[model samples]
Target: MPYDGFKDVKQIVKGDLEQYIIYQNEEVELKKFDNFVNLNDVLNEMEIHLKAYNRVASIQFYGITQDPETHSYMMVLEYEQMRIFEKI
Candidate 1:
């Protein structure tokens, strides 16, 4: 299910390899790593967080895109079966 107070754009933090976006949620803070993060690492990280919420079934990576105006990058995440959050 979609988060109740979801926002399209959240806080952005720039790093050498990735831009991190911390998606605000009532239940937990969801992070989107917009770079070449290792898939296994991402899965492992998500698994730890997802366990805190009983509603979350799985986490899926929806790939990445670059903003035309800012040239910034974003990675998308889907929680459970709902496309609730994206980062850029």
Candidate 2:
């Protein structure tokens, strides 16, 4: 599925640069970026999990936003079948 944009980033908290959210099936998946984690690392990790459940279709980075309140960056990831699945 094509990235619909940042329409999924629910909120941005201050002082935390590693936390983000993924909206799926009327639910939210809270995710954290480990210290020094890069975009490629995140994608690889997600790919493994998606493949485990046979839900892998496509994945992409939707966007990145800096929270004015926290000055932290939020990275949004978009997925195809995985997002549509009730469980991931």
The clash count of every prediction, one per candidate, is 0, 1
TM-score per model over all chains: 0.29, 0.31
Candidate 1, position 88, lDDT: 14
Q: In model 2, which runs have C-alpha deviations exceeding 4 angstroms?
A: 1-25, 31-33, 55-88
Candidate 2 clashing pairs, residues 3+ apart or interchain: 14-70
- How many residue pairs clash in model 2? 1
Worst-scoring 10-residue span by lDDT in model 1: 79-88
lDDT of 2 by residue, 1-88 (tens): 2133224555443332223444444323333344424656655655565465454445454444444444333444444333443343
Candidate 2, which ten residues in sequence have the lowest lDDT sum? Answer: 11-20
For model 1, residues 13-68, the per-residue Cα lDDT tens digits are 33422233333542222344344246566556555544643254454654444444
Show pairs that collide, candidate 1. none
